[model samples]
Target: MHRSAPRLSRILACAAVPVMLVAVGCSSDSGSDGKKNAGSSSSGTASSKPSEPTVEPAKFTDLPDPCTSIGKKTIEDLVPEAKKKGGTAGGSTDLSVRGSCSWNGLDDQGVKGSQYHWMDVGFTRFDSDQALGSGAKRATEDYGKQVTKTKATEGAKKAAAEPAAGIGEEATLVTYGLSKTDEDFVYATVVARTGNVVVTLTYNGAGYAGAKTPSSGDIVKGAQKAIKEAIASVEKTAGADASSPAKDDAKTDAEDTKKDDADAKGDAGSEDSPKSKATPKS
Candidate 1:
């Protein structure tokens, strides 16, 4: 009987060893699964962040040249004249406006893509001289004042000055461009009054890549004619009277006329005059 008890105890011990090994193996597999789940969760969070917005370039179908659309007697026609005065005309494109144009080209600065020319012409009979004069004066004075203020704020000993000939009455022109390193070059001119009306033109240009540097003088020489032509185009369409009402003014005038007509009709209806009312079923 004692020998039988000893054999039974050995058999029980052997069975207990396999159960202990299985528990350890299961624990290791659970740990590995937990790590895989954590890695997946981290990857999901990274993909949820937003990106910055980008400005898309302008696009349009090919159309007639901007200069060609200008009337023969218009200031835009004077582009050839201005070119005769030693100015360069760049490539011209339509800006989608019925009578507007955008001209782009190089100036004497030898800087490519340095010019953006825009022109608008209005065919209405309103005089644009006053409006042109006002806009040009405002632009010139405002530009100077802004530059002066900026210099003062920066604690400069003296402000940079501009030439008297730089300001004019027939055009309000602005030029700005960026260098390769993103430096800014900005300029503007205003021509407020012209022979038959007002002309306003603006120019803006920048160089993105080049070993050669562009001077302010080069920029001016290259862009001045384009700017003048744009303003001339504007003047020809809108005329020289700069002080004329805005485009929206026409809508206001139409509304007023409608109200006047309604009131007049009301007054005529209130009258007892037989002539004011048709005889009912005469």
Candidate 2:
């Protein structure tokens, strides 16, 4: 039997149609699966969000000038021949948030002896952040850290920590000794947190040549005094006067005295006045 060419061509085309349809079906299935995966990924991504904790409001918003935070007299006492009496400011990207200053010098006494001294002060201010905590709380935490850091300094000896009074809301003084330049150096670091600001003051000194080594008590006292001034500066930046604490104490004392006077007067009047009508004097 002889088959016609046209019929042969139609038979081949008919066979190709099923193959093309199957390929299309397979492609459609792949596309559908891709769409499903994309949708699932998008859904999961949209549902993922990190949770945050509730925190209290911050206290202070600005920091003081680190170089001027401490008094000039204090610097002179700490560093007798400081190269820069105003102190050298530390690097800071945000001046209102954090700042530091340092002074180091060697006092030459011409045949008597030479002494070396170093004083540094830093101010860290925290702002209220929703994800973190209140500025005051954050400052307090950092204050503790500074104290610990001073106590755990490498090569430190005779390290001790004690509460610092009359400086701020919370404060600690860490005292330690380290050997340098073939001489023993005494160090005192004051870590204080007031409101939302934290103040860290470190003072260390050593006798050079043949001078006497600085006393720990003196270093501690000087650091405390410097810290007090720094605390006042922190308050000043927030628009509080330097004499605020003293003023508050005076006002409180006056009020208490007035109250006592009133009470005393009342008592005296009661003594003179009888509950019932006083009988004729006998």
Candidate 3:
């Protein structure tokens, strides 16, 4: 009976060995499948990673020289007898980003009194930034700010602003009166934006001695004429491929401005007798 018991025990032990091997094989397969799944999950996560957002490229990487932006003839017409026919460059640390030129003069008319003229053009260029936005979009925002600031000039009187067409992608003309040097001055400022650049031109004139202050319409016309040239200069700095509708607009504006000036020659008050009341300033 003892011998029979020992043999049966041996058979049971052999059966248990097969069961253990089967369990180990199943566990090995499960572990291999788990490792493969983990690898696949990691690969999928890497492959599905999101990409960074992109921004529009900036246009007109550089700016035109503000001093020479206007032609000599234009300067002569705007500031007759100008002390410096070549406009004076305003202080600028970085000409690439921002620049300005100013011209001022007093034309003596003997018994008719002296006429004072002052004009300045400024350019500001913006670069595209992924965080901020496109260059043109940034310039548009700055265009609105500049218009608002011009309208809120200190001691301004009868300040008014209106959209100016055929100047740039967008433009605004702000006219106002300011009392300075014991005389009233008429001022017209044109704020325009083209691509990534902003062009601001301010033209103001006052009568010295007995001369009549310039009329608002004439001043506006002069400002628009000058700014159109200044804005076009930006495209010149840009490569030839950068040509845009702004150029055509400027050409049309120039023709119209010239005709308008000829029609209002006598009414300008600077050349002939005082006709209309003087307009407002800076």
Candidate 4:
């Protein structure tokens, strides 16, 4: 019986071997599953990495000076006998981002009375923003606002807005008639957008004494001419100013060379000797 018991125990041990083998097989499967899950998790993390948002870049980075935005001839034609021929600059904290100039004049014709004219040009520049959008887009928004504001002028009559061509990328002409100083005044405002800049020009005229009020068509034409010139000036000034530093540097070098030559001549003339004068050390 003891021998049988021993044999039975050995049989049971043999049976346990299958269970151990099964356990080992399950462990190997579990390890393989764990590696597979780890690979999947790593791939998911890589894919979940966030990407940065991007926006369109701005076009124009600088603005033209407003005081000289229009040609001298144009100013004379628009505001004859202007009080300030050079145009009075408007108040601005930053001339680079915003600027304006204005002119007013009375052209007297003696018995024929006098004609009064006033003109002003303004510029506003915008920069690109991820939240606000592109510079051009912002300028476009301001362009519309300017038009609306001009149309809502106090005491304005028959205010009208029409698209103006040959001015810039986009333009609007706002015209209205106002009465002031017991005379009818004709006003024409041109709001134009070029790239990231907004150009607003207001031209108004009235007749004093026996003279007749300026025609709306004439005022509109004048405003268009002046605004076109002002817009063109922005491009011209930007190009010229971009290279102004280099030109200034070259001019400075030339002046330095001329001074050096003068100094050499002065030194040579001082002694009329073959020996050189030692430069005094500081």
Candidate 5:
């Protein structure tokens, strides 16, 4: 038995070598097939990598707080007898994107009559959507609808919509007179757009008892000032510079004039060169 030990060892070694080789071969084949399958799937699969849609980023990421957008003094002047000095916050589904502040006062003079005034301001912000449109563009579209709706107020009289300047990119002033509660009411709505934000200022007043009806001119002037403040607030919230919109327009106009002058000079030089280059006919 001692003499046959080497022979048994050799036989065991030979048997183990074949089994190891077979196992290795199987593993190699499996690995190679897996790599091929992976490569094929990568090339043939339609959704190897998904792409995300891109949209233009809005100029303003958020809207200003409606209650604080206008100055305290402005509100005080507009609503002398306002129930809330801070202005009444309108119900809002989302305060970050949309909000409103309103003020109303009914000044009673007993025999002289009472004066009723209501002033409210609202801010709506639009986000840049790939499927819908850019923020500025979208706001412009909504602005038209808002103006039309204001003009079509049920009992509005002498309704007039005139293009407004110096407020925002574009603005419309809708002024109308209405008779409600047996008193004459003056209404002025200014729809303004600043960047991606739209501002709507609705102000109406009626003298209840006998207070002389508020002047439409006065209402419009107040609305314009208030709207300017609102636009400035929006710009501040958006991190924009403190430049007035009127200054921006003036700069643009100056640039246009310079370009026109340069163009005119180029045309004049071209005409003079042609005349100088032309040889005198014999």
Candidate 6:
């Protein structure tokens, strides 16, 4: 009976070895599957990352030359016009007008920037009774108010000067100027007239240095020229003689009415006109 008990113990030990082997094999398979899934998740995360946005650079060829298009009239025209209207046009750089033109500049970091330049012109007509004085007064007041409002803003460091008088009540020209804020860059020049005519020259870029911001005084100069050309165009379309016919006619009618009343008082024989008479008796 003792020998049979020893043989039974050895059989049980042999069966335990296979059970342990099976458990080890199952654990190995589970670990291999987990690794494969982790690798796949890592790869997917990498693929899902987003790319940065791209910025397009401005081309210099996009702008027109103000000199050839606008002719001799340029922002320089403002000098004499302003003086004539008892106003002054003064700034650090001498401006020159050019054709549709674009250029590149640089920023503090040496990053490339771009500029667009353009011109706008406008005009308005008033009767002789309106008085050039009245028109000039309105323009000066409006320009002052605009400058005040602009200076009140937080980021705007400077305010534009009041516009100078142009060619009297028959025509007035104003210029709009834009430049890059990050670096000293010139953007564009727009000219606006009283009667709602406008011409604009635009320049755009990444930084001022790229457009040679320090050197390209063209932005202001071009604007001046465009404004002059626009003013000239407006004058051509609405000649001085015909510019304020409405106001002149109104003034003439008022004077005629005064003269007629004086004459009627002097001559009792003259009866009141039907248009001016009260309603007839029933």
* Estimated TM-score for each candidate: 0.32, 0.65, 0.74, 0.70, 0.65, 0.30
- Residues 11-31, candidate 1, lDDT per residue (tens digit)? 999999999999999999999
Model 5: residues with Cα > 4 Å off, grouped in runs: 1-55, 238-282
Q: What's model 2's TM-score? A: 0.65
Q: Which stretches of candidate 6 lie over 4 Å from their true place?
A: 1-115, 118-137, 147-154, 158-184, 187-211, 214-216, 239-282
Better of 1 and 5 by lDDT: 5
For 1-282, candidate 3 gives per-residue lDDT tens digits of 989999999999999998999999999999999999999999998899677788888887898999999888998988999998987999999999999999999999999899999999999999989999988999999999999999999999999999999998999999999999899999999999999999999999999999998898889889999999998888888532354689979988999999898878755655445545565676
Better of 1 and 6 by lDDT: 1
Model 2, 1-282: lDDT tens digits are 357988999999999999999999999999999999999999999999898766766556677888988888888887898998988999999988889999999999888799898989998888777867777777878887888888899999988888988989989888889998689999998888898888888998998778899888888888888889988888878533244588989999999999999998787768457753466897
Please give the CA lDDT of all the candidate structures.
0.42, 0.86, 0.91, 0.89, 0.86, 0.41
Candidate 4 is scored at a TM of 0.70
Model 6: weakest 10-residue lDDT segment is: 56-65
- Rank candidates by lDDT, best first: 3, 4, 5, 2, 1, 6
- Per-residue lDDT of candidate 5, residues 131-201 (tens digit): 89888888888888899999999988999999889998889999999987678899999999987788999
Clashing pairs in 3: 176-280, 176-281, 177-280, 177-281, 178-281, 186-280
lDDT of model 1 at position 226: 45
User: Model 1: residues >4 Å from true position, as ranges?
Assistant: 46-48, 53-64, 75-282
TM-score of 6: 0.30
lDDT of 6 at 67: 32
